[model samples]
Every structure is written in C-alpha cells, then in structure tokens.
Target: MSSKILTCSVLSALATAFLLDWYHKKFEVTTPPTKNTPRKPRKYDDSLIREQLSRNYSFLGEEGLGKIRNTFVVVVGCGGVGSNCIISLIRSGISHIRIVDFDQVSLSSLNRHAVAQLEDVGTPKVECLKKHILRIAPWVTVETHNELFDINNAQPLLMDGNPDYIVDCIDNIDTKVDLLSFCCERNLKVVSSMGAACKSDPTRINVGDISCTEEDSLARSVRRRLKKRGVLKKIPVVFSSEKPAPGKASLLPLPDEEYEKGKVGELSALQNFRVRILPVLGTMPAMFGLALATYILCDIADYPMEPIVGKSRTKVDGIIQSLAGQQSRLGNTEQRIPIPNNDIIYIVEEIFRGKSPISNYSTRLTLSQWDPAKKLSLQNIVVMTKEEQKLHEQRVLKGGEKLESVYPPEVIQLVEKRFAEEKFYSQFR
Candidate 1:
C-alpha cells in the first residue's frame, strides 16, 4: 500500500511540472522592438524601389533580368562609341560599369561624343563619364581608370572586376590590335569599332562578317594592316566603310608623325596639313552601340548567336553548245567543245533583299571535251600558261585587283537562309 502511494505521488509531481512549462509558454509577454533598433522598410510600399524593379523588368524580361542587373561591362574608351555604349547600357538596366581611358575632354570632342559637355572640358574622360552615369543611376557601381590600356596594365584592368564583356572604342590601331589579342588570348569576348573617323552615311554603316572587305578607304587600310599581321583573317569586327568626301590635308599629325617629332627637336619646322573631320552625329554610333549591347546581353542570356550582315557572293554557270545541221551525218573525228565565258560577282546588297550583286567580274577560259576513260575527265580547261600564272601572282602581290568571293556561293546562301529564319529569335532571345 505504501509503494502504491509513493508511485501516485511521483506521477502527480511530473504532471505538475508539465503544467508549469505549458503555462509559461501560453501566457508569456514578449518585448516589442526597442526604440534604438532599426527596421527594414517594406519594399512593396516604396515607390522608388518599385520603379527601379519595373524598369529592370521592362528592359530585361524575367528570364535574364537578374543576370543583367548583376552584370559588369568594361568600356575601354570614353570617346564617341564608348560614351554612347555606356549610356545605352545604363538605360538598358545594366547596374555596373567601368570606364577606362587616359584622354582629357577637348573642345572638339564636344561636337560628337555623347558624354562630353561644356562643363566637362579639361576633365579626364573616365571621371567625367563616371559622374554622368552616377547622375543617371545613383545605385550603379561605377569605377574609373585614368590610364591608357597597354600591355603592362591591360590584364589587371580587364580582370579586376571580372567583367562579363569588354567594349573596344580605342582609336589607335596598334592599341586596338593589342586589346583584341589580349581578350582573345584570355578567352574573353570583346567587340571592337573600326574606322569611324571619315564616314558620313548612316545607311552605309553596318555590322557584318569580318572576312568580307568593304570598299571604304579606312576599312581597306585596316584590312591590309590586319591581314599582314594575320589578325583579320578570322577575328569578327564591327566597322563602317562609307567613303568620305575629299577635303583639305590634315593639320593634326598622325600618331607616328608625333612619335618622330618627339625623337627630333620640337624646333624643327614641319608644315602642318589640314584634313577634314567626319561629321558624326549621335545616330550611327548609337545604333551600333545598342547593337553591341544587345549582342552581349543575348550571349549572357544563352541566346543563339546573331548573324552579322555583310556582302554576299553571287556565282553564275553557263554551258556553251555548238549547233549541228539537221539530219546531217555526224563525223567520228574528235569533236571540238566550245568555251563559254563565265563570271562571278561579289555584292553588298541590302540585308533584306536577296537580288543584285554589288560588284561583278568576268573571266574567259578554254574548254575541252570530256573523256570517259580518264579518272578525272576535263570539262572546261583553264590553260593558264606560266606567263599567265606569273602575271596573276604579280597582280595578287601588288594588291591591284580584289579577289572573287572568299567564300563559296552555296555556303553564303545557306548562311543567309539561316539568318533570315532565326533573325527574330536572335533579336531578343
């Protein structure tokens, strides 16, 4: 009886303890946030926050909006193209930008450069542009490098923030080449601007296959120099080739001329020549800049590559047949085959239209009858003697004549068809 009474007492004690713990939790009084403590403002009720978010969504849709807001773009020149590109990137919702340049704003720069203003004169391009960007997007992270991009400093500047894309707007050819090689070696994607100095026609400006040559003088010179170095053989480039109007000789000495002058004494008398500067408004650079930004964004978003439009190659084939007398007895003697003149044309037609060749060339060749017995039968023979071969080599070496299309016609046709079919998706994908 005593053991049963002890067990009942212990059970009652355990139930009493459980009731005490439950009572503490059920009727507890909690302290509110202290006066000194801070609370995060609700994002939904903030109009500024809502507007920024809406802009991001409107510019870069839901799928890639986050990526764009987080991306870093390094623009390597604050001249015409760089300034325009940076502005477009900011307006497109890109939140991080780095401007690198060693130039100071001058009076002449105000006419063409987007970010150059009267008040910005004498200021470093990088600093001035960063200030402009901050004014537009205060939340954006803007960094500036007031140094020229050279072999020694390029690597660090390029790799510093782990840039997602690099835009080349440098004017010097050697510098541009160095930047391209550096980016290519590091496997970083980059887009470069070609000669935009002397062109005026906006319609003539275009982005296209880098292999094809345009008739513009600046492009030709660039192509020659780049080809000599084997750089333009495969690198994709964005350039315009519209011929500039003839003007007075240039007053501003070439970069090489300046170097030579530095080697010599400044007292040496060198006649200054006056050259015409191309009239560049905001439209062409703006268009190309936006296109470049679109390409970069599309790449980051895992979209299909956009086809660069360029000159198309057109080829024509003709067969010549000799007339025979009706009901006449045929001779068994070796029949003679006549040669038909053939021509190939390389044309820069409108990207939308598929008709008309821009340039044409005709060449004549000797023809021979096909032989079934031979493994490789002769159909049309070009019996170019040694002298002809020597002349052809001479012309090629002298760069007297442009070659026929560098690519096959069928390949170009296939590419054009693919471009047309996938163009819409490429724009926003």
Candidate 2:
C-alpha cells in the first residue's frame, strides 16, 4: 500500500512538470525591440568569372562584366551561326542565356556548327547547345526552348524574362521577319545575320544597321519586307560586302543522273516546301557568328565596331535590287513563253517553286531525266504511293493489260487520274 502511494505521488509531480514546460514554450513572452541595426548585404565572390574573362577585363573592365552578367541573351536558332554566337557570349562572361530551336542535329550540320559533333546527330540543337555551353561555362544559367520561334511562341519565349539581347540566326525568312518585327515594335536590341553561304571572305564581313547593310542577299530581302511593315531603320544586322565570284553563283550540281535525290533535307516550316541547297563554305558561318557576337558584346560595352559602309554599288546588292524591281513589273502580265511539254520543264518548275504544280508534292521529288525511248515524264514518279498501290491492284483485276515490271505503279495511276480529272474539269469549262 505504501509503495503504491509513493509511485502515484511521483507520477503526479512528473505530469505537473511536463505541463509547466509545455505552457512556457507555447505562450512564451518575447523581448522588446532594439531597432537600429542595418542588414549586411550577402557576400559574393566572382573569382571564377573574373579569372575566366580576365582578358576582356583590360578592355571592358568590371563595369562590362557586371552588365554581361546582368544581361539575359536570347539566341533564336542553334545552327552554325547561332552555336558560335552562344559560345562567344558564354566565353565573354555572359552567363544568362536562352536558346530557341526546333531542329535536330543532322550529320551535315557538323561542317559549320562549332559545337556539333558526330555523336550529336539526331539530338535537338538547343539541347546540344546547352550541353556544349555547360561543358565550357559550367557556371552559366542556360534556359532552352526546344521550339521554333514563330509568332505564336515568340512573345512567350522572348518576353518571359525580358531578354537584354536577341540574336537572329533563323534560316527561314518569315520567322526571321516576325522576330525582327517583334524586336523593332518593342524597341528591343537585336542583331540579325544575312546570307553567310557562298561567302568565303572573313575580312569582308561586317556589322551595321539593316538600312546601312550592303551586298548580302538576305539583308536585301529582309530590308524590303521590313519596309513594307514601316520599319524603315535601326534594325542591326551582320552582313558580308564581298560578292560571290561570277561563276560561283551556280554552286549546286546540275540535277543530272547523279543528283536525283536533290536537296534531301531542309524544308520550309511555314509553306512546307523544300529549298535548294545553297553552297556553304564551312568557315563562313563561323566568321559571321563571330562578327555578330562582336557587335552584341561591343554594344553591351558601350563601344561600336568599325563597320564598312559601301560607297560604290555592290554587285550582289545590285542584283538583288534589280530582281526585286523586276518582281513588281511581272505582276499579272500575260507574257506567254513557249514551254516544252517535257520532264525537264516539270522538274525545273518544281525546283524553283518548292512544289510540283501537277502533283502538289511539297517535298523533294525523286526525279531523273526523262528517257525518250521509255516515254516517261517528270510527273511519272518512281515510287508507289498508297493510292497508287490500291489502283494498281484494282487495275490488275480488270485484266486489260499487264504493266511492265520496270514501270512504277504511281506512273500508271497518275496517267489515269490526270486524264479523268482533265475530262471532268474540261466538260464544265
């Protein structure tokens, strides 16, 4: 009985002590304020950035470095020009970067792309760019938008963080114009690239306002379009004043027996059409990219590059201007020219317009020169399309005639369809 009474007393005492401790913590009173202490700014050491970009410090100083770090740069395409631009920016201590591209690295891209490799084939360009940037400037904060920069996404992609510098290296004209228009409308700083293909002179490349640029086919096209939108001047561009040598204009081989698979890749995103493969000298894009980078960097440092202004009429610019003028005069003029009903005519039209008028095929046609003996035309495709396969089986059931094994099913179907459609449309006419 005595032991039980002692145990109860000890439990009561312990429970009371626990309740007192809980009350003290839960409703504890705080000390009154002693108010006048200033908060210390967090310490930062830029030793790595300082060391890496030490060479630039002599020219730009810490002020330039600060601006570069604070600046958010956006590179639109991750091709030869863009890849180099991103790298130059990163090397110059521009840490905040965003890349926008939708293309996968093709085996052909390695010739000019500074960051692309054999292993990078089939990888998205923006993803590959991020990896490459991280390899060199690991401290950089890179954001990638693995998408095409179109009007729909341009606002979101560019304005999300309010980029400081936008680089235009896109291959497509419409997209380029859209990006440039957006920048111009918002008064954003941007530098664009012109035709770097077929250009070999690194010394001739320069940077200037789009209005002041000369000798570049791309710059001329862009200028004409921007003028239509009332964007007359102040858009910066990197261009080459060197003219492509006289005979070098026709760089692509004739679509003879050899180049039947003409311009295999590279299709237009907007029109869904194939463009001719312009000859690209490997180093030319790199040179243009470096020039573009220099312009942007110098612009950031409050310094301007010594851009070459053309005094005489440039051969390339003169040709482009004449073509533009001719385009206006050719509007709805019924100047009939004799067109031979031959395979070559069809192939030539398709080559220039990016699609065959008869078949409406937007991709590259696997076409060869017509053999007069075989009685074939360029419209006579070699491969069996799905519709042709069905028609071939149906025609075989009629048992009228057996086609030669060498003749493709598509050719037979095309002939029948063309005749049938023509007869129907002609009856109405």
Which prediction has the highest TM-score against the true structure?
2
**Candidate 1, residues 35-118: lDDT per residue as tens digits?**
212122122333554376686576557777667767888889888778877887876667777788887888878866777789
Off by over 4 Å in 2: 1-45, 249-274, 311-429
Candidate 1: where are CA atoms >4 Å away? 1-50, 53-56, 216-234, 243-283, 303-305, 313-429
In Å, residue 419's CA in model 1 sits off its true spot by 32
C-alpha TM-score for every candidate: 0.56, 0.59
Which candidate leads in lDDT? 2
**C-alpha-based local distance difference test score of model 2:** 0.66
Q: Report how far off residue 60 is in candidate 2 (Å).
A: 0.9
Distance from true location, Cα of 47 in model 1, Å: 6.9
Candidate 2 lDDT over 1-429, as tens digits, reads: 999999999999999999999975654323311221111211325786688789988788778767876788989988899998889998997878888888899998899998888899998888787767766766777787776788898787778778899999987777898899988888888889988888887766777777876557778888889899988658778888664433454346445643565554434333542355778888988888888888888889876456665433222233233323322343414332222333222223312232333355544322221222342333332222234333443453233335644346775455555434434333322
Which whole-number lDDT from 0 to 100 does residue 3 have in model 1?
Answer: 100
Q: TM-score of the candidate numbered 2?
A: 0.59
